[model samples]
Target: MTTALTQQLVDLPVIEVLYSDLDNTLLGPEGSLLTGPDGRPSARAAVALVDAAVGGLTVVPVSGRAMPQLRNDARLLGLSDAIGEVGAVILRDGRTQYEWGECPGGIARNPHDTLTATGAVDAVLDAFPGELRPYEPWHRGREGGHLFHGVADVDAANDALAAAGCGWACLRDNGRTGGWEGRSVRAYHLLPRGVGKAPAVADDLAARGLRPEQAAAIGDSVEDLTMAPQVGAFFMVANGHDAPGTIRTPGGMGEGFADAVLALLAHRAGATRDNRQAPAPAEGTVVPSTVLVVEDDEMVADVIRISLTAEGYDVAHVTNTAAALSTIQASPPDLVLLDIMLPEVEGWEVLTQVRSQPHTAHIPVVIMTARTMPADEVRGYNLGASAFMRKPFTPDELLAQVDGVLQDTPRA
Candidate 1:
């Protein structure tokens, strides 16, 4: 079923920036880069990302990986900015401009006196013994902050650090699926008290003159949750740790998840331009009409929401027939934008249910779908759909149809 967070994402009108976590969030289930049939990164995600960048969404990789690892991966993926070592190091334009202890461009203040508290690291190591091992990338890059792996018991690890009076915060990687036995191998990054992904992301956004609402963050673990408040939307992969109100993709890693987000961003960019030229509602008739959109595809649903909302309509969307019926029963909208193809129950059944109800019978329903046969139109119209609109429609066409439907429907 399409989640509420997914619907919310679809309704977003603009996404100026994208902040993402690496590892399981962007890679496949095997903890490697997701490849297509061609043995390279999935084309759908790659192309969509490229398209998003071309359309003006700045993509930044926010990861626990160290500088060298992040740099190599970013180069391979064509990404330019990255927050590495769980925000200890900030790389912009392929250069390290800020480290944990030092502030650059006066964007961030050093919250901690030292980048790495050796006593804290030693304490955790001494406590966990063989269970905790040094994350090698920090040593290779010679950067501050220490990352550790093989932390199956996050509580114990944190307790160990606390017992040692270490001045560090433990960020857990709940998204990592690899581990001995049936349990997953958990990883933790020991960051100084004031340095974290959220602050680092905020600093970067501020540098670009962007607000938190202008960006979206995607990740798979609790560590990534630190970035939730810093972006317009937060998405968690299906297999990752849960955060309240986070949109989850059906596909794990970067598969269907990244593609869906990129598609929405591209659509938003196009709709923004089209909306500028769109005609406004008639003067003095300012209160917008309420629209209920019933569609299954998150990407298409968002596109429709963006388009109709731009034309000054209050839009509500649902992904299946059950939700459509429930929404109609709870609060019947002025107009219903229905899609013929739906999950569980088809759109045809939803239309029948709406018409069968007393309160919603008079509400105008516009059937919008990719089904472009004459019989399909006849079928929809026969089932009480007020208008039939095929897919691949422009924003102008959608607004025009909605206006026509609302105008033809008489007020009760």
Candidate 2:
């Protein structure tokens, strides 16, 4: 299934602000901060963020890192603003400009005193003994949240915090704890009950006179999920933990996931503006083209449904090959969007079956799947597929291909 991230991006929301988590979401698998030859963040990602910012999208770093680390990242990425310390601190123009509640900011400060939080940190350390060690930033009095490394068991640590009667909540560092060459000692953050990335992000948006629907968030861990409800859309990097209704990027370990998203947004924005100026369709046009989508992923199906519907096409989606065949037999659609990866009854077999049948043989079929090898594309075309689209396609590209195929094929 297509992920929630894909659906939202495909629908082309006007995202004025983008909140990106650092660590695994923007950094390389080896934690490299250097841009690639293309001057983009990673090898696979495009350098569209610069264009996005130039086009007026505010790209802000929202991470759990301390102020110093956040500043370094902002410098490297050419970003000017960030929310650090797990939402306790905010930086603007390379300076620590605001502290959630302590400073003049829209977000209310956590009512719990830092002293009380320090006590909770002490309790957890004492309970876990040698197992839990404070991260270096904590010793420097980083505000917003206290971080610790060497957590062997997150649940047990949370239990210890609860038993100590500490109101602070324990959040596992999902970003730093996973993927290639990941940290061996898992990290956890202890924050006041009401403090999170979401509230801090909300404050930033409000300060800029923007609403939640005008922003989007990208993160690679569970902590990032806290901000999901506060934004128009949330993107989970490929290496991050899975969450329902989040857009999933194909790139992982900061390998251009952010860049890809920015590129899609920029493309969509341009398309929308051009569409606005383009001539309208003739009056009383014939029924819009009907498309049959054969894919198992509901998220992907939804993306196709929304995109095709917006372009004035009727779309019918089926999850399996059996249903696809039944629908075609009952009422053949103008075109078929087939995916090779099906639960059972592979799409190639379906293609072959359709081609051998006289009634359905004339219908055009498009192959849209993650299997993008040359051999796969060749095999699909050999089986009479009309067009081939790789996974992670933009809405504009999908529509263009559909239009091309329809224009080439003679209507019966």
lDDT of 2 by residue, 295-374 (tens): 88664566567667667789999989999999998998899999999996799987998899999999999998877589
Give the poorly placed runs of model 1, Cα more than 4 Å off.
1-13, 36-42, 99-118, 128-131, 136-139, 150-186, 278-412
Model 1 whole-model lDDT (C-alpha atoms): 0.69
Each prediction's RMSD over C-alphas, in Å, is: 9.6, 10.0
- Point to the candidate with the largest TM-score: 1
Error of 1 at 224 (Å): 1.8
Clashing pairs in 2: 1-297, 2-300, 5-246, 5-247, 45-256, 101-109
lDDT of 1 by residue, 32-129 (tens): 55563234566445654654565567778887776778888888888888888778778886567554532222322332223233366676677777
lDDT of 1 at 38: 32
TM-score, per-candidate, Cα-based:
0.57, 0.55
Worst 10 residues of 2 by lDDT: 103-112
With candidate 1 superimposed using the best TM-score fit, by how many Å does residue 289's alpha carbon deviate from the native?
21
lDDT of each: 0.69, 0.69
